[model samples]
Target: MSKRKTDEVTGVETTGHSWDGIEELNNPLPRWWLWTLYLCIFWGILYTIAYPAWPMISGATQGVLGWSTRANVAAEITAHEAANAELVTQLVAADMPTLPQDADLNRYAIARGGAVFRANCSQCHGSGAAGAKGYPNLLDDDWLWGGDIDAIMTTVRHGIRNTLDDDARYSAMPAFGDMLEPAEIDAVVEHVVSLSSSDFDAALAEQGAVVFADNCASCHGEAGLGNREMGAPNLADAIWLYGGDRATLHTTVEQARFGVMPPWGPRLKEADIRAVSAYVHSLGGGE
Candidate 1:
């Protein structure tokens, strides 16, 4: 090897590296920093050996400690479930109407039901249960079926207009686009609008009254009050499922609406269904 070059000014050795006239100093790293770096490398090796680190084709290498975050989480879940086992049992068998009489059961149901609602019902009914355009609001007294706790329970268990469950609440509005003239449909739309609003054509509504009585009154009632037995919504209320606007009303009248809610009875546990029902009933809308 060639003798190392020394800088005359600083009396320090130069590394083999150079650029233009600048040369690199062959200076040693600080003793503390070097020792710290070596300690970090040793600690990293220990960590890899003691805890999970390397990924394999099928899974990560299970370290010597054999500890798992997943296993810990599962254990915690099992413990919580064990604690709530009695309350869940009570919730399943308890009379729905008399649920509020038992404060502990009612509280547990609401808390558990809220979690179920957020995970399942929130996609359609909204996180706050205020409802979307086609979905019914749980916070209001207006219900297409009924607002009582029993009614709410039945609706939750069976659902509305779904084919999956045999006991599902079923109803179908006729597509009047195929049954009636366009002018006749428009007239009926105006009449329906007149039920909840003052901004409607008198002439159209008058003609539509006769049409409504013949076609819609059986399900909607003579005054458009709606028949809950038939799952018909109250038209007099400003709250609309699809909408009460003229355009929306016209589409609803012409094409008709067939909204479907999947049965929860098959998917959720009996206790869960009851809990969700109780939770819905407590939202100020249930009678």
Candidate 2:
């Protein structure tokens, strides 16, 4: 038979359960532990009273402090705006050409521009400014328009192929399908392809040169070198805007693909536009 033991300090009865000769004693919780638990409960009650707490029919209780998540966000935004006011003012006052000279202002502009580019320009001119086919790569030195700071600013302010902007870059490559015979376009394509390589057939080039001089030479130049003012691409360069294949050239001559980019000035803030233009200008071979 096992015997039960009572706790001498509390005069409480034993649990009457024993394990491995160790008997369980029914003792009161320690005063300190009990007080700590009570403190937690009291703190919870105080927190409920001081902060937004119980849900009602329509909404939760507005605590005594009247604090809200919205208020906290507004306060943070106000503080940030206050701090950036001087920088914003300086950026607005400065012109695009002079932005890069001011190191602090340029850094600020790039940061602002990066965000705007990610949101707007990243679809075509990727996040890193590496463009897809038909879209001009901002990273590369090859610009359809002039590559200067003022030129880039003008391009952004008035988008290319945007009919909405009356002053948009309006010149386009006319479809030679209606203008020239299929055989002639083919000969020109072959001649254009040959400009990049020494593999051109002299006889065919000689025959095509007459057709090119009459029709294409005005925009493409006498030697097939592109005209920037007319947005005509350089024929001799390895970097091709629309692929350098025979089929692609045929399609370009047949349909005459014109790509369009949106103007950022109307949608984005001036500082943000400046920053993005600077960032694009700083890309690989951007000068």
Candidate 3:
């Protein structure tokens, strides 16, 4: 047996292990610290027994309480729906045209409608209702269909140029490229250009006026003022769906524009439809 050694500085006994001349202290941990560690292990075991702890083949261990976060969330949703039942009923029964007449109901409708617009209409019309190139701007006075509350409701319900609804707004502009000779088409283009501004060859515009009277005037008025009944856009105004430039105008005259809007009546509830219509009408450009 080797001789036992003591530390010179603290006078503690050696652990009987050494590297070179250095020795490890035989002093144990503090009693309070050891007890604290034991208490933590005990608490952890208790917690495991009381709560969801061990994983099983199919699921996790369910404690005696039978608590589930998913079930709690489902119950909360059911409760919330029950709370709004009355408002939903009123919204469904309310007259759409006269909806704005009732101040309280109108405010509630607009609030709900804003949510509806964000979810559905925002994809095309944008969140702020500022539409893109093909889409009509909701914030503008120009409307292909009527902009009144009744008209807006109808358009939203049935949609535009879509097969989903029989009463959907439909109009077809003939591809003049197929119908008119290249030179005739050119003359017509000049006339269409002159409708909004004086930036055109006067001789070509005069020739196009004759072509306009024969073909276009049947739907569009002689002055190019749009006929809302036929879903025709006013060519005289500066507002353009695709563009207003000569090149864009040439393309429009050569090939017609056909845009489709799917009917929302089958997908959205009546209340949601009316609410969104009200929201749009409230955007300050409604006639």
Candidate 4:
């Protein structure tokens, strides 16, 4: 048994751990710090016992409190839905064209519809309903189907060219790539370009006019004003869903476009669909 050495200068006990000429002092920890550490350990044990802390094979252990974050969130959502129930009913029942006549109901519908649009429609139409490259702008009067409130609602419900819904607005432009000769396609592209812009070859556009009258006039109308019933876009309008450039027109003539919109009728409630339609109608472009 080795006797613990003492530091002669301080009269304190030594741990007998030495490096070079220095020796380690056997000092006691501060009482306050030691008490704090003990309290922390006790608190941790209490927390584990009172709350969901342990993981079992099946699931996490539900503590005595029986509190759950998911349950709390679900409860909150239910409360909000209940609060808006009356308004939702009114919105669904209200005449869509004359909805704006009732200021309060219209306001509520627009606000609720805005939220719905942001969640579902914003991915394609944008947050401000400005639209992207391929997507048609909601803030424009150039609707391929129609821009009226009822028309907007109907479009939302059934969507465009979608196979899932039987009543989906279906329109198929013939992919002229296999049908038309390269020269004929080029001529048609020039004519289509001349409809919206002045920067087009006159001779080519003249040749294309014959081609347009023979093939495209049936759906696009004699003056390229488009048929809403057929969902054909007006070529005369500067607003283009794809693009108005020469190259874009060329591609459109050759391959054609088939823009598809998923039917919201199956996914969204009638009230929600109406609300979003109202919201879209209020975006300055609706007729």
TM-score of 3: 0.73
lDDT of 4 at 210: 95
Model 2 bad stretches (over 4 Å): 1-79
Tens-place lDDT per residue, model 2, 104-179, is 9889878877877888888987777888898777877887888877788778878898877776776788899999
In model 4, the Cα lDDT at residue 196 comes to 85
Considering every candidate listed, which one attains the maximal lDDT?
Answer: 4
- Relative to the true structure, candidate 1 reaches a TM of 0.82
Deviation in Å, model 2, residue 225 alpha carbon: 1.9
Which structure among the candidates has the greatest TM-score? 4
Off by over 4 Å in 3: 1-81
Q: Which 10-residue window in model 3 sums to the lowest lDDT? A: 80-89
How does each model score on lDDT? 0.90, 0.82, 0.87, 0.92
Q: Quote each prediction's TM-score.
A: 0.82, 0.72, 0.73, 0.82
Candidate 4, pairs of clashing residues? none
TM-score of 2: 0.72
Superposed Cα deviation of residue 40, candidate 3 (Å): 17
Model 3 C-alpha lDDT per residue in residues 4-24, reported as the tens digit of each score: 678899899888888897898
**Residues 95-149, model 4: lDDT tens digits:** 9999999999999999989999999999999999999989999998999999999
For model 1, how does the per-residue alpha-carbon lDDT over 35-83 read when each residue is reduced to its tens digit?
9999999999999999888999999989999988999999997898799
Inter-residue clash pairs, candidate 3: none
Q: Which stretches of candidate 1 lie over 4 Å from their true place?
A: 1-64
